[model samples]
Target: MRIIFAGTPAFAVPSLRAAHAHGEVAAVYTQPDRPAGRGRGLQASPVKLEAVARGIPVLQPESLRRRSAQQALRDLAPDLMIVVAYGLILPQAVLDIPQYGCWNVHASLLPRWRGAAPIQRAIEAGDAETGVCLMQMEAGLDTGPVLLARATPIGAGETGGQLHDRLAELGAAVLADGLGLLRAGIRPVARPQPEQGATYAHKLDKAEARLDWSQPADALARKVRAFDPWPVAEAVVAGERLRIHGAVAVEEMHGAEPGTLLRAGREGLDVACGRGVLRLRVIQREGGKAITAADFLNARRDLVRA
Candidate 1:
C-alpha cells in the first residue's frame, strides 16, 4: 500500500513514523516553517523535520483549495492518506484523491470532543476518561465516521502536557494497527458519530489562564493543570503577577474572602476560595523562577498573614 502522510507538530511525528512502517510513504505534507525563538529564525515543524530526516518527500503548501495544489497531490497516486493534527482543512476534491479515503487520528472519542485542544478541554472539564479515535474524514468538522478507538482513564493529578504525550503514543499504535488491517484488504467499517452529546473543543485562550478565586478551589486547580506548558495559570496578588504551577483543593468550614491569603507555611500557602481552600504548592513571581510556596514565603516575609 502507498500512503501520503499529512501532519504538523510533535504530536503528529509518531503517527508519521508509524505510517512509514506499514508501506511505502509516497510523500509528507506539513505546515510551512515559521519565525520562532529569541532570534526569530525560521523553524520547521516537528513533523517536517522528522520527515526530512527519514528521506520522505515533503510538501508545505499554503492552501490545498487551489486546483494546482490538488493536482499535485493527485499526482502522488497514493492508496490512502493519513492525517494527524494537520492544521489545514482538506477540501473535498483532495479528500477524494485517495482510494481508501483520508483518515484522522483524533485525540478524543468521536462525538464527544471534536475540535482543537481536546486534551486540555477534557482535563478542564474534569472528565473521568478520554481516548483516541481513528475516523474516516468528511467535509463536516470532526464529524467523520470512527473506524477504531482506544480508551484510557484520565488520572486525577494528570496535566495537559502529560495527557498530550500519552495520547500521541497511543494514537501511533492505533494507527499502525489500522493500516495493517487495510493492507490485508480488509476495509474497516466506520460508524457514524452520534448526534447527541456532541461538543466542540474550542482552542485555548490566554484569558482562561487567569485564576478566578471566586470559583471553587477544585475548578481552579483543574485550570492550573489544563493550562500547563502554555499560558500557565496565573493570579494577581497585591499588584504582583504570580504563576501558579501546582495546587490542591481542601474543604473549608469557613474560609476567608476569595483571593485572601489565609496562611503561608511549609504546608503550602493556603488561600481561601469562595467555597473551599486552595493550597498553592508551587509558585513563581513575575521575573522569577518557580519555587515552593514555603520558600517563596520565606523570602517575602510580608506574604505571611501575621
Candidate 2:
C-alpha cells in the first residue's frame, strides 16, 4: 500500500519511521521550514530531516486548505495518510482524498487533553494515567473515533521530557499495530469517544512558567515537572530569580509566608508555600547552567543555613 506521512516535530519522527517501514511512503508532508535558533537560520523540521535521509519525497506546504496544495497531495495517489504532530489543520476535502482516509496518532487519549500540548498538560494536571490514541481523522480538532490505544501510568516524578520520549515510542508501536492489521486485510474497530470527560489542552505559553508560591506546593511541583526542558518553572528565591529544573513537594508546616526561603541545606533549598514546602533540587540562575541546589548554595553563602 502506498502511504503518505505528515508530521513536523521530533516527537513525530518515530511514527514517520514506522509508517515508512510499514508501506511505501510515496511522499511526506510537513510545515515549511521556519527561522529558528540564535542565528535565525531556516531549519527543517525533524520529520523532514528524517524523510530526506531516507530518500523519501518531502512536501512543505504552508497550508493544505489551498487548492494547489490539496491538488499536490492528490497527485501522489496515496492509498492512506498518517499524521502525527502535523501542525496544520486538515480540511475535510483533503481528508477525503486518500482511499483509506487519514489516521492521526495523537499523544493523549481521545476526548481528554484533545488539543495542542497534551503531553505537558496531562503532567501539569496531575493525571495518574495518560496514553496515546490512533484516531480516524475528522474535520474537528481531535474529535475523532479512536482506532487503537495504549495506556501507561505516569510516574510520581516523571517530567514532561521523560514522558514525551516514552509516549513517542508508544505512539509508533500503536501505529505499527494498526498497520499490521491493515496489511492483513483487517481494519481496527473505531470507537467513538464518550460525550463526557472531554477537556481541551490549550497550547503552552512561556508566561505560564512563572511559579506562583501562593498555590499549593504539590501544584507548583507538578508545574515544575510539566514545564521542564521548555519554559522551565521560574521563581524568586530570597530575592534571587532562578529557574527551577527539579523540585518536590514537602508536606511540612512552616509559619513563614509563601515564597520565603525556609532553609538551604545539603538536601535542597526549601521554600515555604501556602500549604506545604517546595524543596528545589536543581536550579539555574540567569545566564548560568543548571546546578544542584547544594552547589547553588555554595555560591550564595548567605542562603546556606549553618
Candidate 3:
C-alpha cells in the first residue's frame, strides 16, 4: 500500500515510523518550516526530517484547501493517508483522493477530549485514564468513527510531557495493528463516537498557565502537572514570581489567605490554597534552572518558618 503520512511535531514521529515500516510511504505532508529558538532560524517539522532521512518525498504546503495542493496529493496515488498531530486541516477533496480514506491517530479516546491539545487537557482535567484512537477522518474536527483504539491509565504523578511520550508510542502501536489487519486484506470496523461525554479540548494558551491560588489546591496541582515540560505553572509566591514544575495538594487546614506562604522546610514550600495547601516540590525562578524544594528553601532563608 502506498501511504501518505502527514504530521508535525515530535509526538507524530513514532507514528510516521510505524507507517513507513508497514507500507510504501510515497510522500509525507507537514506544515512549512517555521522560525524557532532564540535565533529564530527555520526549523523543519520532526515528520519532515524523518521523511527526508528515509529518502521519502516531503510536501509542506501552507494549506490543503487549495485546488493545486489537493491535486498534488492526488498525483501521489496513495492508497491511504495517515495523519497524526498534523497541524493543517484536510479538506473533503483531499480525503476522497485516497483509496482507503484518511486515518487520524488522535491522542485521546473518542468523544472525549476531542480537539487540539487533548493530552494536556486530559491531565489538566484530572482524568483517571486517557488513550489514543485511530479514527476515520471527516470534515468536522476530530468527529470521526474510530477504527482502532488503545487505552492506558493516567498515573497520579504523571506530567503532561510524560503522558505525551507514552501516548505517542501507544498511538504507533495501535496504528501498526490496524495496518497489519489491512495488509492481511481485512478492514477494521469503524465505530461511530457516542454523542454523550463529548468534550472539546481547546488549544493550550500561555495565559492559562498562570496558577490561581484562589482555586482548590488539587486543581492547581493538576494545572502544574499539565503545563509542565509549555508554560510551566507560574504564580506569585511571597511577592516573587516562580514557575512550578512539581507540586502536590495537601489536605491541611489552613487559616491563611490563598497564595499565602504557609511554610518553607526541607519537605517543600507549602502555600495556602482556598481549601487546602499546595506543596511545591520543584520550582524555577525567572532565567534559572529548575531546583528542588530544599534548594529553593535554602536560597530564600526568609521563607523558612520560625
| Most accurate candidate by lDDT | 2
Model 3 clash pairs are none
Window of ten residues with lowest summed lDDT in model 2: 297-306
Q: What is the TM-score of each candidate against the true structure?
A: 0.97, 0.99, 0.99
Tens digits of per-residue lDDT, candidate 2, 1-306, equal 999999999999999999988999999999999999999999999999999999999999888989999999889999999999999999999999999999999999878999999999999999999999999999899999999999999999999999999999999999999999999999999999996999999999999999999999999999999999988999999898999999999999878889999889978999999999999999999999999998998899998863
Q: Rank by lDDT, highest first.
A: 2, 3, 1
lDDT of model 3 at residue 191? 98
Of models 1 and 2, which has the larger TM-score? Answer: 2
Backbone clashes for every candidate come to 0, 0, 0
TM-score of 3: 0.99
How displaced is residue 86 in candidate 1, in Å? 0.8
Task: Give the TM-score comparing model 2 with the true structure, all chains together.
Answer: 0.99
| Candidate 3 CA-lDDT value | 0.94
lDDT of 2 at 213: 91
- Mind giving the per-residue lDDT tens digits that candidate 3 earns over 1-306? 999999999999999999989999999999999999999999998889999999999999999999999989988999999999999989898889999999999999989999999999999999999999999999999999999999999999999999999999999999999999999999999999998999999999999999888899999999999998887899999888999999999999978889898888888989999989999999999889999989987888988872
What would the per-residue lDDT of candidate 1 be over residues 1-306, giving only the tens digit for each residue? 889999998999999989999999999999999999999999999999999999999999999999999999999998999999999999999899999999999999879989999999999999999999999999999999999999999999998999999999999999988998998988888999999999999999998899998999999888888888777899976457899888889888563679887777887877788879888898898889988988887887887773
